[model samples]
Target: MELSLLFEISMLLTSACAVLLAGWLLWQGQRQRAMPALAGFAAMMALWCAGHIAIVQQWPVLGIALVLANPLMPMFFLHFAVQFVADGSKPLPAWLQRGKLLPVLYGVTGSIILLSWLGGGGKVISSSGFSAFFVFQGIGWLNLLYTVLLGIAAHLILWQGWRIHSGNKRRSIVAMFLAGGWGLLLATSFVFPSLGLNWYPYPMLLLPSYLLLLVYGVVRYQVLAINAFANKALLWLGMLLLVLALMALVSALLGQLGMQALSAVPASQLWLYSALLLLLSAACYQPLSQLARRLIYPGGQLDESLLAHWRAELQQAQSWQELALRAGNLLSARLRREVSVQLPAAGDTATGLHILCRRDSSGWQYQLTGWDDVTPGYRLQGEVFAALLLSSCRILEQSLKLADAERKRLDQQHLVELGALSAAMAHELRNPLNIIAMAAATTPAETRGHIQQQLKRADRLIADLLSYSGQLQLQCSRLPLKPLLQTILSQQDWQGVQCQLKVPDGLTLYADSYRVQQVLINLTDNALAFCRNQAQAQICIETQHDNGDILLYVHNNGPAIMPQQHNSLFQPFVSKRAGGSGLGLAIVRRIMQAHGGDVCHRTDLGWPVSFELKFKQQPSALSTQIQDNIND
Candidate 1:
């Protein structure tokens, strides 16, 4: 009668646990990534009951069911470990993958365990000390190895959980698995055998539920999303569960002692006993850690603190290096995760990437104790900081663009005013230039030598005036630089003084060719006239095109402009010679400007007087001007 009653009570407790497990696992199947695995755990429990019925009826079919059930323990755990720490990836890899081997190994191991069970190596013993009963397994030391393997697998699952990235919600799930697996393994190994060997059954059957959250992570969003990690909901749930479990343990102890005293009470009073325990468990939760504070902090002292910090971030110069460091700090501190961002080489083509973090490699920043970068050997877990990472990238780009735009706007305004002043000054000087030309024309044959000198000077002045007033706009048609230089020199008969124009072939400039040629002509003319001493004077014009700037240098072994006047070279009416309108180089500078080019004095006094004119280049540097007319 005692043995049968014990079996009957054990069956009731197992049945109740099976029902709860089934309901929870089934509900969770729809939510998490490893629902199929959790359901497998539920089926294992439900089928476990059938093994007893099959044994009672002497049915042979229960043999298969019993054998298959053992593997479910590992299968569920392996699946949860994958899900809990986000190790599992879809389209699971073949033979090489940890995922593929898990289920496959379960099948092989289950067969071995089953063969052992049926071969008389294992027996189930029923125990009854109080109103509750449980079946204890007596197996050889080999069976003890089974417990050891389970313990090891549980440790792995727990380790995987704890290693999850810092900013992810999956960490909570991992923490739960860690706690439960530890509890289950310790209970079976030490707790059950102590104090007259009371086997209350696996108390931490909710590991599968946490795995459900991982499944949810896959469908809705990653489990380790920053927002999910920051959320305190699951943490509260875990605390509540811990409190309830402790209350039940305490209540069961006190209730059992009371039952010993009150022998008149029915054994079925265990239902009322369990109920009271659950209620007390619900009440024994950790103190609510300031619900009002969490809500009001955004608008209160915390808000003030955050605003001050955000303002400081704004004040920091938006250099890529500074922004990167700031982002790294936030990711490290807020998520409690370590991360490193690497920049691609100047020529790399990749747009984006997300790599897993691990422990064996130098994966993350130094602050994290165990975590490292991902590799085949190391697995990554925790939260995915994808959104935050992407956000930082965009913010950096925007800040750079804003700074560049502000600088360009200020520069453009100055250029526009300078252009206006040039136009006004050209208008003011035109009439005076014509009067000087008339005076020089009228001085004529009466004083021929002086008249000729004055006439020649007046002619040069008129050319400068015209060049200044041109206000040339860049035509911007693509043309070769060599042909343009040749054409400008061709207009000048450099007979007495030989000229050598050396320019890279196929170099093109995007500018008004007319204005660019006009500047070159004025520069070459000035260079040739200054070659005073030598009978065979030499003038060489060299062109260098780089970084979209065309640098044309007109050189002559002539007197150089004074160092003090270099800044004033392009200004109107500034000259190195007397009776000079001081406008030849000035006119060249203005024409270069109209073509979006600039002319600068290349070197210091008495050195080869070189005038450099620069212009922006077009798409291709290919020379395509028809008919090479520089045969002269």
Candidate 2:
């Protein structure tokens, strides 16, 4: 009698818990894709428990309802496992799709069993010791077979998912696998006593074990996304309620067992003891709840210390590029993904932490490539950490900006001193060269030619120094692109060289004509020097419009510049070719920069050596001319 009463109490408690969990899981549907199936399975489990309670109360209809719903519980569990492992953006597994008719077949089998029992083809044997037993007469064993098969199938799917996934996702599936497999194994044991076995079927006592595992999965791995119910007060209240339920359960079981200590207490005095116990539990709630939270979220407060460390490390960054690299590396280590930081001018490619620095006035964006792989714990605290990280980046940007300003100021001062020295050298060297040229003219013809060539080289070097050291003053006008190219090419002596002009006759560029001419001359000279020995040497000048800017490409069939020299190609006083003025490309770059343009070496399909000039579209009187050219 005691065991029967104890069984009844356990059924009531587990049923109530299942219902509550089902409701909560269903409410979490907004965040979890698997919630509906898990919630439905929980509801079915609650109904199964209620069926036992109804049978004890002599309610046969509800008992039959449990038989009808038995096959569905396992199906729901299998569905939950499939959706749990399946990605929302991807299709379901092929096996699942192929077995779509299995659920319908199971439903039909269950309905046939229900009909057989209702049509007097089955018998229900009730025991008088307050325990209910189920017996299927004709086709009822088929229902048991279906239930066992479905349960096995569900567990197989879970095992497959466990083997397939890794990391936190796999851990969550392990919880489900253990819980579902254990629950099915125990719950299946309930039918043994009806099969002419002398088993007591005490597995009901261990029925809640699976439910506890499910709770672990939900809490630890974010399987159900219960973050909404994770508030401190709510968590404490839940703990308190759990303790109260456990106390009630233990007291009821003890009373059923007829324990001497509890049997001696009066019914009236028990209320006072219960009230005192509640008061004591209330008092201890704070510390217990704190411990629970600490266990659940050990890394919740870790970001504060990490943020401090990041701030210190980021403070030591010397430039914007260095700061961005350091910040990207820090975030990548913390989030465990590939992260890249790009300036606003570099273009956005991925979705991630965008730090808008009002201090630097240039928005710095960080892209985290695999954001979906971030663990839930860090994702929950992402906003706070991102804000702190952004603040750190902004502070670094400010410091780097100040440092750059000082550096630029010093560079400008150095350039002023260098410019003064260059001017004085050019003036002194020109007078001595003039005297030498006159002296060499009186020598033999061969000596005179060599001296003149040396003097010309010196003069060209002086001219290059002056061009590099001097500031540019632009007198911008709309110059016809084709006519300008023709004039520049006509001035150059390309001996038996093919020079193709691809500029449109109507295309006009808004730039300083003199500066543009100098830029073209320097590019042509650079090209000719590289390809002077190659037979059938060719140079091609082409113009195209791109995003409101004009792109001028000069291509030459010359040996490609070595990769080692690319960086210092436009740097003054760096040259590899003999009898070459190294400042030619440097002066060209300066002239282009003064016109709000840029020059860069590019590798095209056929051209081994190519230089591209990018001219910004000016919003001046040339707009009409530019628009006409675009239309043409």
Candidate 3:
């Protein structure tokens, strides 16, 4: 083909590719706001390419019409850049926004240029006594000046956007600048021919290089929000082209060798030679394809051995943090990018490239910094790696949950065994203790009193153990708060202490009356033990209804519990007061839990120390069955 014809064909193909890519992006919902403008730019370039071919073919009217229509190309490009960066939210400066008027001025100028060219009054006259280059002298100069002005304005806008953006966004803007800069250079090439240098190549012929750079930006950097790696249709097309190129190459090499050998063969034998060549090409197709895939897509598939090794590593990971670290290292090594993992902690400051998996209260963050040159094959690999990482995280979370559940189950079993032993020991000691009390009663009144007090303490301890063992049953009933509090306060020994009830008369609780009394008594005793030394020792009993639950707060004028002891304060045998059985709070918590309620220490209430008991307004069937079993 002739050189100009070859250039024209290249320009047409490039323009078609550009148009198809932009249109496909628009259709696929990739950067919808910016894609239409990019499509317009591509379509205008296609028109320009067509116009150049027309000009080459001596079609003046069509060429002039297309060239005049070409002024809107840069406007569309500028529109795309602005939309891409601002994302239709950031307001452009007034001067930059005024660029929308350039197309209107260019249209009027194009009309004048066309008129001047038709009137034959704008031909450039060479001083070398030779006529050269057909262009509208006055109008073409004016058009060139406006094109330069538009190009400069577009670059300035792009530069401002680039400077304002950061990180990934900044990278995308840089790609835009590179693509647009090359486009500007091509646009400037038009000035050469208008300056009486008609020997210069047509600016449209440079479309292929410009389109390639734009495609790189779109596909690799996702400059237009077009993730070409994720586009299966585009990937298939690329693979098809690669296969075809490989076949052509293999056939050409084989054909040359066959032709050399068949140079002495007769014309009748040419058909046999052609048949042999076809057979050989078919035979080599699979092997060549495999070779091409290996060379071109090294990272497309994960090795089975590598995957198995990773699985082993994941199994050995002790915690989520350890698993995250291993996963980050694996991905970093595979992708050749800096990778970091962030685990959830107090005031955690780690960040990631993206979040891979998040479930329940756990998540995984992966970093892919410095992987800007990532190919479709590598991207596919990264996706597979991400899947692996997510699966590993899921497995780790499940393991932790199962382990925690098993530990709780075992701890409960141990507590049950301990409680049964304590119950047996208390039963055995009760008879002997009663006999000893009887013997002490005969010896002296003082001895009898001391023995009775020690016997009572042992009995209370036994009762607490039974409650802890889940043997204590609840007879749940809807009971009013006011009368229950009055009766309990009248019965309790309140020496040198004042008790205040803040409960509303209408408020009621759904719990066993006896068990609720026991809970209040224990709380009051614990409070009085701490506040007895105070000049105004006081206990405040308050109740509130919240979100279908009843909250009862027992406040005491006592020191607050230290933060470190908060977690273990409710466990059996853990007491802060000297010569006191630690089972009071523990039994309180156990009773509340069994009743389908909960008890927690709170410092935000009526006094320095308070314990809140939360009871469900309406008990579920399960809680009723549990309460019945406990009573049995």
List TM-score per model, in order. Answer: 0.34, 0.49, 0.47
Question: Can you write out model 3's per-residue Cα lDDT over 1-632, one digit (the tens) per residue?
Answer: 24555555766677677677667656764545776777777787778667655665667567666665555676677667776666644566676576666467557545654554555433333212113223545555555555566566666777787777666656767887788778777766554555656554556466677865775574455444445443743555465556556555555566567765535443324433554565576568769987887788776766789888877886778787777777778767876765565444312324444334454544554444434567767766766676677677767778988898888778677777877798798789888988887788776778778888888987877777776665656777778988988988888777788888998877878788888888888888888888888878888998887898889999988778899999998988999987678888888887787677889998786578989999877756435434332212
In TM-score terms, which candidate is top? 2
lDDT of 1 by residue, 1-632 (tens): 24434443444445454556456556644556665564555555446554544443445345334633554555565665556455443222243245566667667567656655655443344333223222334333344456457647755654645554454444455545555554455336222522356554433233334333433333233323424533644665566566556555654676567855544444345444654565565455333334444443322222356545643553363665565455445544533445443322212222122222212344222122233433311122212233333444455567777878887677456545655665576566666766765666665566656756665676566556655544344445777889877777778866578887688888776765676666676677667666745666888877776686777777788765667877887777776655667777766765555454566777753345777677755435323332111110
Task: Give the local distance difference test score of model 1.
Answer: 0.52
Off by over 4 Å in 2: 1-298, 303-306, 319-376, 619-632
Best of the candidates, lDDT: 2
Q: How far is candidate 1 from the true structure (C-alpha RMSD, Å)?
A: 20.9
Instruction: List, residue by residue over 320-368, the lDDT tens digit for candidate 2.
Output: 5676667667866866755655543334434464333223446644333
TM-score of 2: 0.49
Q: Say which prediction, candidate 2 or candidate 3, comes out ahead on TM-score.
A: 2
Local error of candidate 1 at residue 500 (angstroms): 1.8
Q: How should the candidates be ordered by TM-score, best one leading?
A: 2, 3, 1
